[model samples]
Target: MTRAAIVGIGQTEFSKASGRSELQLAAEAVLAALDDAGLTAADVDGLITFTLDGSDEVGVTRCLGIPDLKYTSRIPQGGAASVASIFHAMSAVMAGVCDVVVVWRAMNERSQFRFGQPIARGNIPAGGGSSFMEWCLPFGAQSPASWEALTAQAYMHRYGATNEDFGLVSVLLRKHAATNPQAWFYGKPITLEDHQASRWIVAPSLRLLDCCQESDGGVAVVIAREDRARDLKQTPVTIHGAVTTLPFNHEIISDYYHGHDLAQLPMAQRVAARLKDLTGMSPPDTQVAMIYDNFTPQILMQLEAYGYCGHGEAKDYIRDGNLELDGSSPLSPNGGHIGEGYIHGMNLITEGVRQARGTAANQVANVKTVFLASGVAGAIIGAG
Candidate 1:
């Protein structure tokens, strides 16, 4: 059997508005990763990306002038599919179906359209909206914040968590981002008081600061067999334990009612176990984490689900400065989606590679292993 590794990673500057097409953004990132890996389009034989990425494989292939493709695929389910794209590439390369697969995600989210605005209600069955979304749309639970707020409220109530607890996460991530030149919020760190004073987007709990930015940019990674990666331009970040798991009766973002527990993400917990089982490594072995912080509450929940802390203990763990660059867990030193640009969690994926490479702007100390999670899917990247 073959092993997979990420030999290259690249990104465009995170911005509110990128005055370019999605295809252009995708091509630029792809080319950057190829150059970083000391390879070219001719070395790529497969491609994988998010279903939401506006640029398709054919267009990106044409832009790169690639001769042919042996494999191409897309994964859906929003942010959850972020790491799943890497998982797809790993499987493809490991199984000998293809070699040198490029995984990418690019979007003109802000300049073209805003995700914060309410989605207009329509017939909506053009492979567009999920059937699960239709149930909550009529009740004004259309946007991600609104849908997630229900569960956030429940989590807060159960754990005695307040908005201040959530604010702590926002504050810490912004602090990390402040020094990262590529972060959109770079040089703009916030105080806890600032988080408290920020306006509410779906209130009683969720604040504007708690929500992630709608960024317009692109990120891409080059995955090659581990042996080939060892001979590349940079340290090979071996892909260990890439897994995606869903618990019984999983619904996309609207995981709040009936049988679904409102306080925890069961899928994430299962994924945590899967990672440990696959790699025989646990949270204590990791030097840094690049968890998806699409929303602040989810960040806390992920910490608990991934065994970094006990259930309902994440806020306290964070308050002790465990998430700081010098702290124990050292999460998302590149600012995460909250402070970094949100390209469907692709930035976090690249950050994991950066940590292992010792090239992160806000470097974690002696990082040999980096943990990454894209909602339900996750992977462990290690310097080998």
Candidate 2:
């Protein structure tokens, strides 16, 4: 089988307002990634992005003046689409459908729109928006915070975890972001008290500090065949394993309807199993974990789901300082989505690449493997 690797990574500044159109942000990020790869627009033959992205391939192609494209695709499922984009790119490269594939995500989430806001029923196009929204919005579970809280209540009840326990996840991520120059919260570390004092977005589970930032930014990466990546500008991060698992009856972020325990992330478990089967590596084997942090509870749940700890033990695992830079599992040294800007989890992918290359802002020592998990999707990136 052919192999694929990430050759370049680029992103615009993380900000509350980028003061530019989403298209311009996309173009800039794509160009920056191509430049980082020592490749030109003409070198790109494939493009992939999220269905939620406002900038389409034609718009980005026109802006970059790419001669032509042989393959193009859009992945859905919100934040899960981040790693899934890599899965598609790797498949395309391995299958010889394209030579150089650029995956990008650009948005003015804070400036132009807000994902944290409640979705009006009338605003949702008939049969177009998420099916989960239909079951949630009517019951005052309108926003992401509300839905997460509703689902997280089960875990807190089952494991006797407190809000402060979840707050610790925010505190640690903020600490990491404090030292990370690219993070939005750089040099702004917060304490457990600060996390507790923040206004509750969802009482009992989520606080303002616990929620990830809705930032205006763009992130892009270039993927190529391993043989081609060897000649690229940066140390290529090989795609050892890329897998996305959407288990039956599972909803997107608020996966309550699944016939399993709400405290457990079935999709993440499936992804972990698939990754180990594909690459013979598990979460404990990796030096770094880039788990998505749309909310604090997610980190804890995924910590358990990814086999870092046993069931109901993630709170203790996190409290033991295992998520720190020098700990057993240094998590998202780039501050993750909590401290870093949330480019809908795309920034996490770039951070994974940096870790594999030993060039991250908060570089972990001897990082041979980096694991990226976005609830339903997960991938193992190995240093090349």
Candidate 3:
């Protein structure tokens, strides 16, 4: 099969308030990505983004003056759509449906809307076609933090993991972010003591520091056939594999009712298995792991699910310094969503591209392969 490669990446500054419309952010990111690829709006024939994005294809085309578009798509599952958007773009480019595909996500999540607020108090509707939310909203699991806290409690009980263990994850990522000039938390390193002192968002499991930032920004990447990408301005990062899996009984962030172990993330396991099957590589084979960190406990769950460690062993794995810059896994050297701004998970994908290109701010040495995962979806990108 033909392969696709990510040739360019761009993002607006991570901020609490972009002071712009989501459409403007999308246009700026897309144009920046195009410029990075040595292409223009005319070269873009395909577009992909999250279904939750406020900007539509028509708005983007109008703003950028894109003359013609051959393919356009939107992925669902909220932040899980980040890597899945690449999957769609890669499939399109490989199958000859389109070339020069652009995948982007833009949001005024902090200034215009807040994802951390309770659904009952926010603009998000109760049902919103989510049966899980319908069941969760009435019982006080009304926000993403609340929904995730339920699963975090079960995982902690099963593994004897405490809030301190999770706080370590936050500390490490913040350390990385402190040196990352583009990160929202740049120059703002925090200690485990600081993390512990932070107020609890969900008692006994999640702290205020454990949660990712509700950032306002946009991120975009340009993809093309591998052969064409080699001729672009930047090093081509080949998409070796991209996969998304939805196991039975799985809900979005509230994945507790799966009739299985709450300590394990079944969707992440499936995504990792599929990625391994497709790429002949597991988490250990990659140089950097850009696993999603919407919340700190999710990082531990994914660390295990992605084969970085045994089930219920992520706390030990992290304690052993495996996530350090020179350690075995070297997770999220770009600071991840916990310390970096979160454009959903799109920022993570861009960091993966940068790692593959050997240009990341906190670049992991000799990084040949970068692994990206967002719960149900994953992809492996390698330097080409």
TM-score of each model, paired residue for residue: 0.97, 0.98, 0.97
Worst 10 residues of 1 by lDDT: 122-131
Clashing pairs in 2: none
In model 3, the worst 10-residue window by lDDT is 120-129
Give the whole-model CA lDDT for all candidates, comma-separated: 0.88, 0.91, 0.91
- A best-first ranking of the candidates according to their lDDT comes to 2, 3, 1
Best by lDDT: 2
Once fitted onto the true fold, the runs of candidate 2 whose alpha carbons sit more than 4 angstroms away are 122-129
**Model 1 regions more than 4 Å off:** 122-129
Cα lDDT, model 1, residue 280 = 90
* Candidates 1 and 2, the one with greater lDDT: 2
Write one digit per residue (lDDT tens) for candidate 3, span 44-66: 99999887899999999999899
Output the lDDT of residue 83, model 3: 91
The alpha-carbon deviation from the true structure for residue 141 of candidate 2, after best TM-score superposition, in angstroms, is 1.3
TM-score of 2: 0.98
